[model samples]
Target: MQQGSSAHAIVVLARGRARVERSLLSSDVLPLGYRGAGDMAGESALVGMESYTENVIAMEDCDVVRVPTSTATALLRDDPALMQALVSTVLQRQAEAEERLTSLLFRPVEGRVVEFLLQAMSRWGVPDARGTVISAPITHLEIAKAIGSTRETVTVTLGVLRREGLLATAGRKLIVVDRDALAMRK
Candidate 1:
């Protein structure tokens, strides 16, 4: 869903992955984070917002359940447990966003790139004989947006990692060839 659009429904992602982003006035889109199974979007609608505050874009094929705002609001009002769960979800996501923003502000671009790669690997990595392969086909531009850097910077950083034998490219994905060697590395 596009940012600033009227919130019609809260989308529950039942399967697959999606990217969450926010747009700046300069027409730049910044990646907020990724969402996968059991995650949700348009949650502001349930809390009585006029429009969604962020964009949620599917990165691959997905199965989503759309719950109308009215229905979700009513359900939240009626079910204490569900309300509690929603509250927890909101808080957790907020905390993660805070951490991400903080990292962008303080960490060097290369460190951010490595951290992002490691996080992606942990999230979607499949064990390979060579190393841990990230299953998703994440582009450099997407990684750049996520880590608050230019695509060129991310590409160079990845190349550096590969040269150091810490990372490897496999088709559209990447592999973490030496996890320990990359720890807190510059």
Candidate 2:
């Protein structure tokens, strides 16, 4: 969805798709193809772009609250809490993109799988007695797509994690067994 210059508009969609076309006019730093978060969206200087792009890319059948870019600017004008949320969201996306870039460039295939899992946990994980469980359901193919790997690779890597007790597959869900241990893989 397009935004106005002076007004902050929240774009809420029960179900739709958002393709982050371009941000050339909006920011000084021009962007390339859409990366999941920061790589394609940029930093906190462009928080609205990050939030809007992510919700468009990752979420499905979900509820989203859009704080109009203008409203967000005004709230940031006065309220520290809103400012922090905006900054954190942008930085978090940037961090996620950096981690993925590292995996894509330097890490091994297995390590990349772990990175994907950890990223998902950070975004949609729910704490449980065993560990943190992914709040949203995802498939091996989807994970493979996110990491630029094959579905077979994802399946094998997941099997290895299961053997090592890092995760457990319960029905269709992947439940994390040891978050700290998994995070320390790198």
Candidate 3:
């Protein structure tokens, strides 16, 4: 959906990938995070907000379930445990956003890209004979947006990592060849 548009319901991703991004005045968008299967978006609706704080665009074909605001409110009202879980989720997301802001403020682009890759691996990577493989064919532009850098920078950093034998690619997937070495970079 468009940024700043009112959301009447929470869209839960049942499958596939989507990016949550914020538009800057310059017309550039910074990706806040990626939501895969089972992740929820438009959470502001649950709290009675009129609009979504970020724009959510599907990165691939996805299946989603829409829970209307009224239904979500009713569910929270009736179930204390659910409400507590929702509160916990919100707090966790807030903490993550804070950490991202800190990284953007202090870290170099290379460091940010490495950190983003590591986080992606932790969240979605599957162990293989080669290394930890992130199955998604994430584009350089997507990486750039996530790390607050340019696509050219991401491409160069990735090229450097590849030449250093710290990362590899097999078909569409990305493999971290040397996780320890990658992590050692500040």
C-alpha TM-scores of all predictions? 0.92, 0.62, 0.93
| 158 Cα displacement, candidate 2 (Å) | 0.8
Residue 107 shift from truth in candidate 1, angstroms: 1.1
Measured over all alpha carbons after superposition, the RMSD of each candidate to the real structure, in angstroms, is: 1.6, 7.1, 1.5
Q: Score each candidate by Cα lDDT.
A: 0.89, 0.62, 0.88
Give the TM-score (vs. native) of candidate 3.
Answer: 0.93
Model 1, 141: alpha-carbon shift in Å? 0.8
Residue 47 lDDT, candidate 2, scale 0-100: 45
lDDT of 1 by residue, 1-186 (tens): 878899889999999999988888998887778888988888988767889989998999999999999899899999999999999988988898888888889999988988898889888989999899999879999999888889999999999999989998889889999888876573
Candidate 2 vs. true structure, TM-score:
0.62
Which tens-of-lDDT digit does each residue in 118-145 have in candidate 2?
Answer: 8678766788887888866678976776
Clashing pairs in 3: none
Q: If both were scored by lDDT, which would come out higher, candidate 2 or candidate 3?
A: 3
Question: Which candidate model has the greater lDDT, 1 or 3?
Answer: 1
Winner by TM-score: 3
Kindly report which residue stretches of model 3 are placed more than 4 angstroms away from their true locations once superposed: none
